[model samples]
Target: MKFLEELQSLKEQIKRRVQFDVPEGTKNIVIGGMGGSGIVGKIFQEMYTKMPVYTSDSYDIPDFVGDGTLFIAISYSGNTEETISSLSYAKKKGAKTIGISSGGIIEKEADVFVNVPGGLQPRSAIGYMLMPLLLSFNVVSEKDVDYAYSLLKRIDENNIKDEDIAKKIWETRRIPVIYGIPGYRSVAYRWKTQFNENAKVIAYSNFFPELNHNDTMALRDTYRKNEFFFISISGGKDSRSEKRIDITKEITKTEMEEVVAEGSSQFEKMIGLVHRGDYVTYHLAKLRGVDPTDISSIEELKRRLSKE
Candidate 1:
């Protein structure tokens, strides 16, 4: 519970700590990473898939990547083997590269870099990976990453403060079920992963309209009022699915403590709401007293599976 308070304070802590510049001539960006680092690319996929943004977890670069490509090698620990190998591959391919990490191998020789100060788990540092990604694009004007930052800046979650809500929802051991609209699916997934990695707890998510038919039936089977129902709201001005999500949350108030998303624009509000969830889940990790920075179990599993 105390950790939630710490995480809420952390958003401001790292917000200004890691700002940087995107060099000119940067085009066709490619992010190399996996697991937690890779989620940054997935969020970008959902948000800015329009650009030539590619996320590779392997050692090889895509054929389309070349000197014109802006390669971003991200490995929070500064020693991710796959990412290091990929960056080496990217460099050989003549891509302009940058390293995003907490001063790992990627940072050692990256053309440009932004360091994350989080001691929490890599998965919990999604905001750090996320915000920096947005800033890089906004710096180069490829995406409205700056618009997203401004949206995050304007976020007013005072009504949904993590302290009051954390005491009620995440203080105990309860699996969280994150709900969001179609457009905000990425945000929902972020919440789920933060709960799992940082909070070190089980969590799940389902989108609106689609969940109405399937997830609604299993709602009662979830088996506890202790679990929190996070509602990631995206004001869908161009789509009706967002409104469906709002209604779904209203109808399901009987199931759990609901935290709604808030923002003026869809992109702004979606990212803003996600930021709060990020803080909440990371604190949840701390409340449970996990390092939030380690994932040895995941690494072991990956290692075991790779042999197969």
Candidate 2:
């Protein structure tokens, strides 16, 4: 299926899927996965700040994880070694565990199981993975899901414009360095990964305030400007972050291009920016004459690792 068609199907899947309840007395939440499966937790961690939410991409679970922790193991294929290892460790530590996948060992072992649809690329199934996870914690309402669906539908309608702009920005040889304010860091990171996986290009991401302290200084060297294409993603309400973004733009005026996200709510901005970036990566793939859906290197790495 086409990427846009897969995205369009996401909300309908969410609407039909069953919801799980967060266990009572849960104090902390830890999500374990990698690649597309892992990024969902980072997005949630940014949105839900009242309690501690950690995303573990490594094999080892944090020392603080215990019975009070609600550990979520997410792997679309149900066989990601790192997430499975972390989930096993979490279970041994007596943490309440929920597993999200189509079918795998996690489905059998987890205290609660969330079954997402199989077949689509894990990255393309973000809505399927994210909405159910958020709904379980009551972080998002059904109305919010409906609103997001509407927004995505609108984005689909205007995707040609987004694609035209993306085609213009295609730089087959230059590395893409994406930057965002703290609030839009995850979105920027998503864009970076899309370029990496979809366009088969090297990309990197960093956030503001922190980047201003260190990375901003590197932009002074005009020698490297032609080698990199900088893209700054801005969608923050914080005055300090906003100011830093503005100043950083001035500092890198000759080196970087800017893209601002638009939306009234945090969810809208996050998903909206992601929707646009997805198209950009798609167009970038077209410009480079590469198949956007192919990830041969990753598959090769997985095959090699499986032998060990």
Candidate 3:
């Protein structure tokens, strides 16, 4: 699927609810994935607070992942080496495993498997990777999905602002430094990775209060003013962090583009912000004159690894 089409499919994807019968007595939740598929866990970590959520993008499962753990392995292609290896490790530890993917070894190996729709790139299948987790854990309600779908549909129809933001970033020709405040930390990281893979550009991300301690110095001392394009994502929940974000922009004398999330629910706000970033990435790709769907470098890396 093309980038735009896959991105637009989120509205439809949200309507397709996934049902999982989570094992009783499941106490801890551990998710394993890599790259695009791995991001679902990061986003989930931010939304789910009742339990210990561990997101692993490595070849081995965490030492704490044993019986009574609900281990979810997510790989868009169902073939990611790290995810597959981690799934094996989790199974040995007697964790109840649920695998999510289009189709591959994961389907056969997992204690239970969910076959998400195929043909889209892992990054583009954000809805598919995310919806299952949200629904299974009851993290988001139907109303939240409805609101998010409505917001995304509206954005898809009118994205002139997102295009303008892309143009501004493209004009700088500098690495993007995305900052998220409090609730939107994972969203900021998602924006950074989207810029990296979809825009084919290097991007960085850090959350507020933490970045203030160290990275703020680089704005005035180490890096030139034009070395980075700064963007701040506002969650609107933390007044102190929001004040810090405002102060950081002012003190550094840096021009930072900001995206403030809007919605009644946190889930709606998160999905809306994510969709906005997707549009920005698409427009940036066009400005760069590159194929948004092409990830040849990643493919080549996989090919070389397969040889070994």
Candidate 4:
């Protein structure tokens, strides 16, 4: 959390550059990529206004895409086969296309291209991926930056002892399942993936009303008494799903522990909760007694897939 906390200001320094036109006259939007890069599109779709955004990780373009569509080819490394394949397909169809990468093959193919600074591992650059998209679409506001910063300040003020929280959450050596409302679902997802890649642990997440209606019934499935449960909640009491969250808390008492995220806006709350998750995962890596800075498995997987 401390390391990621340090990057909050760096994230606030949002920058944008003129790339390309919106396919002459496109309306609907489709973002194509995979893994961590695809998550960027999903984050944009969730938070961005007006535009109907869809993210595709497969080779096929969304059926609705056409000349009036804005297709974004997002590959952090610029060389993902699926994203490249989709980029080509979108371009050949004459859809308005924008390419996002660290200067890969997709950069050469895009009509409007953004080559963000490369060299950092793609997963480590999620903020760059998200910020560029927000800047590109002009979706971000001063409020977003201020909100995130305030949340970070609040969390730091609490003086959350990382080692203590780490011990409590990652004790069982099993998996941590995170739950939250739709507004904070991405944070939950981030936590799960962070554990998967960083802590080398399996994790899961679910949202409010959806979980309230169905998942609440399995409170005592007898399979997870000792398993770790994490709940990520919005700091805003008046957030969209606040009512559903209240109901969730009223019901599930002994099952999972709650980690409150401090922020006044959805954007702040989401990032704030994510800050805690990142810290938790990072510390867990250390507690598991593993080095916090290595990911040989991901590189080897990429190598193996490339060989095939």
Q: In candidate 2, where is summed lDDT lowest over 10 consecutive residues?
A: 9-18
Best by TM-score: 3
Predicted candidate 3 versus true structure: per-residue lDDT over 1-308, tens digit per residue: 66788999988988888869989999999999988999999999999988999999899887898899999999999999889999999999999999999999899899999989999999989898899889988988989988888998999999998999899888978788889887788889999989988899999999888898988897766546687888888866667877888898788777788888878888888889888889988999999998888889999998899788
For residues 1-308, write the lDDT of model 4, one tens digit per residue: 33444334334323333334454466888899886677778777777758788888898997787888888888889998889989888888878888888988988898888777666656656666677677556665667767776665665555355446678766656567778666677677777777777678778888776887777776535457456555555555655577666566567653455666665655666666766776777778877876554668877887898799
TM-score of 2: 0.93
Candidate 4 accuracy as lDDT: 0.70
* Clashes per candidate, residues 3 or more apart or on different chains: 7, 0, 0, 1
Least lDDT summed over 10 consecutive residues: which range in candidate 1?
A: 136-145
The models' CA-based lDDT, in order, is: 0.66, 0.80, 0.89, 0.70
lDDT of 2 by residue, 82-122 (tens): 99999999999999999989898889888999998888888
Best by lDDT: 3
Candidate 1 stretches with Cα past 4 Å from truth are 1-6, 13-27, 58-60, 116-128, 139-174, 206-239, 246-258, 265-268, 282-308
Summarize candidate 1's per-residue lDDT along 81-139 as a digit string, tens digits: 77888888888888888888888688886778778765755665666776776655552
lDDT of 1: 0.66
Measured over all alpha carbons after superposition, the RMSD of each candidate to the real structure, in angstroms, is 5.5, 1.9, 1.2, 3.2
- For model 3, the superposed segments whose C-alpha errors exceed 4 Å read none
Q: Which of candidates 3 and 4 reaches a greater lDDT? A: 3
